[model samples]
Target: MDLKSSTVLITGGSSGIGLEIAKQLLEKGAKVIVTGRDRAKLDEAKAKHPKLEVIQSDVADSKQVETLKQAITSKYPETNIVINNAGIMRKINMHENRALEDVTREIEINLMGPVRMTQAFLPHLKTKPEAAIVNVSSGLAFVPFAISPVYSATKAGLHSFTQALRIQLKGTNVRAIELAPPGTDTPLFTGDEFTKEDTAGPKPMPVDELARAFVRGLERDVEEIRPGVSNGLKWLSRIAPDFAVNMLGKSAQNMRH
Candidate 1:
């Protein structure tokens, strides 16, 4: 769908890929509203782009998502695009002693967040003449990252969910698109426990370049926009699923402390 003149809501748009996407969309003449959990970060993002509408909401919380849906729909009735970009990732050693809740955080934010947001916004999106839902999954969705098993699993689930959503939304105004990003230079990968070596394959994609690729993909109507190593991962998963899994497992072995 043409991005110009579209009203877009991007979750976790305060920084990283989401922020980059918002910046590009604004440049493309789209009305952009960005949501984040931190009010300070949201304010900072707004400071950078005065035209950006910043909302403080946690995608992981179902109640907050409901409230966010109502607030956005009421104020920005023209909103026709929803980008489920808010997510969290952790490098957890499953064998280590850890709180149960901590182990599944990726599921809550990475997987369920988009699922709930889609449910909350699909009805409104369908009302528009043309609308789109972009879910930012990961290349790991096709092959498990052994070091980040849960994160990979959640992304895999999200990939499946997006495919189903696309099929279900067939014949409707809303179009579901999945963006399976390769490792990107974002805080999600630079967290305390993570290092360059910890990443399963190559260095992260530059955030700006990745964002540009996404916009181009959307303009071209690509259903699954897998950039860089992500595209390779998709192909590898299809032709050499076992080898791909083994290679990723070896990468995790290299990451072991």
Candidate 2:
């Protein structure tokens, strides 16, 4: 719970929300190790924050996940916090032709990636005095976003998994926390990641604002940290599931039309 002397590992920490979370953690005196798939982006992140210990690893690969687990456990034995923040999104048109492997890339990274990472690190995390597993889900987890069908499905699955994980780990030293963030102005949803038309929704929460809310949630030991519109979406989904899904789908109708 106390980040002052904690050692943390964040996957896909080179850019976007992951990078922001890593920076805020460093300021709180936590030893942060960031892993990513790209060497250049990792280098850029390290250049910005000299305190970061950058490792190149893809969470989507089982071999690489094992290697990362071994490396972190062996090298940074003090690591008590693991953040499963590595994820990707796209505005996919399912009607278009594509390989099955390519069609399910989001599931591999967003859902299975966190599941594998948590399983690999659970033993090590339990050995600590206090530990935490943070999974970054999405606001879309509450209701399907029509344009990114696969991406939304993965997030919904992750949300359910995190809930079950928390129940299983009850009375344990390790805590499972889910961060369901609304659109944040990150590379994940910005630039060429989505077409200009695909981004037609509520303005994204500022990255710094989201980071602040996240740190506060950790300190307060909040189990689910849903920032900005994410909180509203969850409430709406619970009260009016059909209305919520249809409203969100309206924003994505452009993709089909």
Candidate 3:
């Protein structure tokens, strides 16, 4: 709960939301370590934030996660927080021809990565007096984004997993937190797969602002931090399920033409 006294490890910390989170957490006096699959990007992130500790690790790989767990638990024994943020979003047309492995890429990184990380680090986190596991899901978890079906499914799966994990960890020192972000101005959202027309809804939230919101939520001990449109998405999904799904599917209809 005390950000100042926390030593945090964030996956996918080289850029976008994860990087901003690392920056803010460091400013709060927390020792921040970030992991990314790309060495060059990790170096660049370190160059920008001199205080940040960078590690090259891929969450999609089970072996890398095991290595990361050993490295962090051994080196940073005081680590109390782990943020599972490494993920990718793709605009996949399920009907189109694609390799079988390629179709489940998001599942490996976005969903299973956190599951593996949690399993690997749960014991270490439990030993700490104050510990938390934060999963970065998406607003699309509540309402499927037809264009990015796999990405949406992964987030939705993560959201469910976090809920179950929270219940399983009840009465323990560890806290399970979920941060479901809305369309944020990040590389993942504005990447090659998506165009301006696909994201014609509300303007994406600024990454820095989203990070600040995340920090505040953690400080307040909020279990699920849904910023911006994420909260609305959850509400709509429950009350107007059909309309919510249709609204999200509008862009996909255009892609089919």
Candidate 4:
């Protein structure tokens, strides 16, 4: 888990947390490749960090996922770290009429995207002397956020998948690490999803702080890295599940009105 010598590929790396992680990793001397669907954003990221290898691909697309795997693995044989960080979030009112496909978009990108990428890149990762797969989940995975029902569900499933993946990869060179982050000061929240009430609470962890914690976890070869309040959410989910849900539901109630 020495990131200094690892070549890493991070999906959704054009903005927010992913971009921050890539920048930090690059500073640590890791070869970093960043992928996103937006050509402009990818270009912007490349402009910011000249060392970044940019790939324009969407994890939600099976064909593109395969193409990315083939391209990166062949191009950077030293690639031993894959960070499945690509995802999207939306506020949907289930009571309102919506297409089934639209309703399930979060599940497709947030949950299935990682599943696809891991399946595609795992064999290549295993061949290395030491490798790591980091799946970024959310604190909401432990406590469902009623406003972002679909988004929360996907992260929950991803948390479960990471647990099982670790067990399956036991005694192997490839280490499965799950990074469950609490509400962070990222574009993912400050964009369309934020409400007055959502922003009224305590400030979230800064992106750089989260990135630093991630590198610390990587250096320690940790199995799970929960930053900021995410650790509290995990404990609350286990000891007081109903209370945690109710507390989260209160925040969602604001969005409902």
TM-score of each: 0.96, 0.97, 0.99, 0.97
Alpha-carbon runs more than 4 Å astray in model 3: none
What value does the lDDT take at residue 255 in candidate 4? 50
At residue 237, candidate 4 shows an lDDT of 93
Off by over 4 Å in 2: 254-257
TM-score of 4: 0.97
The number of residue pairs in model 4 that clash at the backbone is 0
Candidate 2 per-residue lDDT over residues 54-140, each given as its tens digit: 999999999999999999999999999999999999878877888988999999999999999999999999999999999999999
lDDT for every model? 0.92, 0.93, 0.96, 0.91
Off by over 4 Å in 1: 254-257
> Which candidate number would show the highest TM-score if scored against the true structure?
3
How far in Å is the alpha carbon of 167 misplaced in model 3?
Answer: 0.4
Name the TM-score of candidate 2: 0.97
Between candidates 1 and 4, name the one with more favorable TM-score: 4
Clashing pairs in 1: none
Deviation of model 3 at 175, angstroms: 0.4
Summarize candidate 3's per-residue lDDT along 1-257 as a digit string, tens digits. 99999999999999999999999999999999999999999999999999999999999999999999999999999999999999999888877888999999999999999999999999999999999999999999899999999999999999999999999999999999999999999999987778898888989999999999999999999999999999999999999999999999998886642
- Put down candidate 1 lDDT per residue, 1-257, tens digits, no spaces: 78997999999999999999999999999999999999999999999999999999999899999999999999999999999999888777766787888888889999999999999998899889999999999999999988888999999999999999999999998899999999899888866667667764577899999999999999998999999999999999999999999998875674443
Rank list by TM-score: 3, 2, 4, 1
